[model samples]
Target: MTFSIPNLLSLFRLATAPLLALVFLVPENQNIANIAATALFLLAASTDFWDGFIARRINQSTSLGALLDLLADKLLIVTALLLLLDAERAPVGACIFIVGRELLMSALREWVAQNGKSSTVRVIAVGKWKTGLQMTAVPFLFYAGDLWALNTLAVGVWLLWAAAALSVWSMLSYCLALWRNE
Candidate 1:
């Protein structure tokens, strides 16, 4: 089975997620761990965009590649959320809302598919902004308790609030699209 470069990169990101979690969980090296975890998270997040670009450009898109890419995104996001919660850097309610949005969207996708509808889950522009805010907020929050200035945490909190707003809007957009299609 020949794997494309993008597919290999996705797999690599998935493989590193556990190690990232382990490093973050280490108590003795909190600062270094957070830095490493942030770097790993950024790298994995970048691959999310790069993989799709490469796939479309090279015509190497496959069902497996798509599935792997989605799974990698989930793993990275969920792991980061859990770590942020553990560190108490993130508000529990915000985390709950973010996770709920993800779950609801996943269910909506499955329901649409099961009803014999086209599974073209279009990522909305606002959803992209939501992801960008999250990718920034989670890492900053992870390092909030570190030696960084208090303003960093404050900004991260504000960003998290923005992300939550965007998440809700995106979820509503998905629901509306599904309803309109039906």
Candidate 2:
């Protein structure tokens, strides 16, 4: 596949996921490491947003680019969540629920494709909002601690729970759409 600008952005985001996960593996200068990882995550999240916009603007949208974009999003999210789980910063049930929803959605998307119903079983606006919340919360959580008097971790935790609620809503919406053969 030709690596267009949008595709490259998606690839960059995808590459960032493992690096974000591996940051915790380095035990030296833990605070600095976390800061760096959080920066990388934010960068990745920016790419996730920009790539779609760029692809649409440049008329460079491709099947591969679309796949890479989705793949990068999933990788970045799951990687960050797993890392937070490892650090004991995120709730176990929430992490598991998020991951499980992602897996189920992926399988549902595959089934939709097999039945020639692409994008019909895809994420809804609530799901996109859930993703936005997740993208916002994950960095705050990664940089867990305080900035000035504000408790970053507490804010992130609350946002994450809201994101989780949105996740369930969106998941059910998709399932209902599929069930009704929409």
Measured by lDDT, the strongest candidate is 2
lDDT of 2 by residue, 1-182 (tens): 87899999999998998888778657588798778888889889999889999999989989899899989999999999888888878887777778888999999999899989886776578988989999999988988878899788888888888888887788889998888876
lDDT of 1 by residue, 112-152 (tens): 77888754467789888988898888767766654444666
Q: How much lDDT does candidate 1 score?
A: 0.80
RMSD in order of candidates: 2.1, 1.3
TM-scores, all candidates, are: 0.89, 0.95
User: Local distance difference test, per candidate?
Assistant: 0.80, 0.86
